[model samples]
Target: MDEVITAADASITGSKSSIIPYNLPLLSAFLSCALAQFLKLFTTWYKEKRWESRRMLSSGGMPSSHSSTVTALAVAIGFQDGTGGSTFAIAVVLACVVMYDATGVRLHAGRQAELLNQIVCELPPEHPVSSVRPLRDSLGHTPLQVFAGAVLGCIVAYLMSSS
Candidate 1:
């Protein structure tokens, strides 16, 4: 009869032990999220002072947060995985979806809110009070807004990751 050794048992008898635990993908994802958010806040605050003559907690200015977040993620993925890799491809698709939703869906939402606010003001006091506040003016990004955000995100990610 031939003796058989199990693969698991054979591996247990192996000479060397190796341990390596590093997940670059998850790290990159988190970094992208943080960088994007921080940039958005900073840019908004800057715009308030630069153009609006006020400092606000939130405002729509030059770049859209929506664009910044996705652009950061996409650039980060490209840094982590090669630009030609599947991971980067997935990130690109996700970025496109986010940008589209921001510009198309949210843009209309803002416009609707503006119209609603105007209508509410024109109504008599007998109308039910709209407890809800006006929709924020900064919901959507113009093409310039999107472009600025994308550029900012790309620069940040490249600078941080390259270092």
Candidate 2:
């Protein structure tokens, strides 16, 4: 497939290797998101001194997985298709929107959830709402987290291109 793989030249490797690994924008995007998510484990351990394995699968952390996934897709599209193309333009726009949402609307929503959770905790046990589960506050990322995720995504896309 033109967008996925190509035949390796026999003169270069002395063998007929068909599929060259890491030649995919989709894979690069996926790997970037996974790496960012995986990094949350180490970041949590470093910051909180706890092995929070759940961070690897949870949303809203040190690095934004949403940002990483979109950014990696954009960068990979740019690298493979050039910035002047419509595909690259679409990817860039998509990335921008995702990053903005991660840092803006979603972040504020997370803050509101935290406040609601705090209020819920202060309620008396006899109250009906007091027995409800706490709201999940970790729903979004800060600007720094988004930036870090974007940088991580760019690095991953660059590596994919070079390979």
Candidate 3:
């Protein structure tokens, strides 16, 4: 009876140890976002020498928050499921779509916004208000941005799973 009880307990504990919860993916996503934002704050502070100064929340900066978030999700999914598994494959495809959108579609839009802003600035103050529009110049992830995001995501996911 004692041996049976001990074996049952060991089996239960082993099952628990092997089971990874679903929240890990969400946590990875949140951490990536947080890390990117914190990096932005740190970079701003370093550049301006003021902890209180806030740079405009940019879309395309070092480490690319969008890339970070999605890649982190993918990495976490991969950890929960093997890389060749269906869940991991889906996550990878989704991440690719998001990264492409960030670097391609949104980037061109930002450039267009910059051009329109310049055109508006050259206009007279008395010109119609319709001529004025805010410019969004930070919209594309550089190679470095994507790379940093991938590295950050992989490291975070691995650590989260291991812990």
Worst 10 residues of 1 by lDDT: 50-59
lDDT of 2 by residue, 5-39 (tens): 33445446543454555446798899999999999
Cα lDDT for residue 48, candidate 3: 65
Q: How far is candidate 3 from the true structure (C-alpha RMSD, Å)?
A: 5.2
lDDT for 155 (candidate 3)? 81
Ranking by lDDT: 2, 3, 1
* Per-model CA lDDT versus the true structure: 0.65, 0.89, 0.77
Pairs in clash, predicted candidate 3: none
Per-residue lDDT tens digits of candidate 3, residues 98-152? 8888778877887888888878888888889545567777677766777787788
Off by over 4 Å in 2: 1-23
Q: Estimate the overall C-alpha local distance difference test score of candidate 2.
A: 0.89
Among these predicted structures, which one has the highest TM-score?
2
Put down candidate 1 lDDT per residue, 18-125, tens digits, no spaces.
244343444444555455555555666675544333312353445665566667778877887779998889878987887787778877777787888888777787
**How far is each candidate from the true structure, as Cα RMSD in Å?**
7.2, 5.0, 5.2
Candidate 2 vs candidate 3, lDDT winner? 2
Model 2 residue 53 CA deviation (Å) reads 0.4
Better of 1 and 3 by TM-score: 3
Candidate 2 to truth, TM:
0.86
